[model samples]
Target: MAEQTITERIGSADQVLGVSRREIMEQMIDFYKLGDGDGMRQMFEAYKNWEVRYRDGKRTIDETIELAKDNFDCVARVADGYIDSGDTTVGMVRAVQLPKSTSGPISEFYRKTIDYQPFDPNRN
Candidate 1:
C-alpha cells in the first residue's frame, strides 16, 4: 500500500475521533511551536505509533489522543524554561529548531503539518 498523506491520516483520525482535522492540526501546531525538536519528535513518534496500534485494534482513539496530548505536555514542560524566563520569542525560535535536530518521521510530520512554511514566531 502507498504511504498515506498527512491529509489522509488527519481525515482518518478525525473520522475515528469525531473531531475536525483543523482543530487537531491547530493543537498540534501549538504544541509543535512550543516544543523543542527532540520533545516534538518524540511526541510525533508516539502519536504515529499509537495510530498504528489504533488501526490494529490494540488501542482506543481516546487513548491514542491522550497519549499524544501527554507527550505534548512533556514538551510544554520543557518549554516552561523559556516561558518562565519571559523570553518566549527565543523559546519559539528554539522550538522551531527542532526540525533541524532530527530527520525522518518527526521532520516529515513537522513539514507536512506546517505546510512547508517557515515557522512564524509571531503566530499565536
Candidate 2:
C-alpha cells in the first residue's frame, strides 16, 4: 500500500513531453542529486500556468482541445539531453551544448523542461 501511494504521487507528474514520467523523474533526481536546480521544473511544478505555458488555445484536454492543435503549440518537444554519449541520450531541445553537461541531465527533455534549453515561458 505504501509503495502504491509513493508511485501514485510520482505518477501525478504525467509526462506530456513524450518522455515517460519515470525517465523524467530519474533525470530530475539525478540532477537534483548533483545540486543543480532545474529552474524549469520549479516554475511549473504544480499546474502553475501549465495551460498557457505549453500551448495557446482552449487549454482543455478534451476532444475539442485536440482540434485546437493548429492554433496552439501542440507539437511540443521530446525529452532527451543537452549532450550524451549517444547510448544514454540523443540531441538537445534547447540551450547550447555546454561541454560540461550541466544541463545534460535533461537536454532533450521538452515537456518537463529538463532539456537543453531553459524552461522559461514568456507568459506575458
The whole-model lDDT of each prediction reads: 0.46, 0.34
The sequence of per-residue lDDT tens digits that candidate 2 reaches over residues 5-101 is 2223433434343334344445444544565455335422433323334554544554333332211111121133323333223333332233322
Q: Write the per-residue lDDT of candidate 1 for residues 29-80, one digit (tens) a residue.
A: 5555665455444435645554655564566776665555444333343344
- What's the residue-level lDDT of 12 in candidate 2? 49
Q: Deviation in angstroms for 109 in model 2?
A: 18
Per-candidate clashes, comma-separated: 1, 13
Query: Which ranges in model 1 have alpha carbons more than 4 Å from their true place?
Result: 1-20, 56-124
lDDT of 1 at 119: 31
TM-score (all chains, Cα) for each model:
0.27, 0.25
Best by TM-score: 1
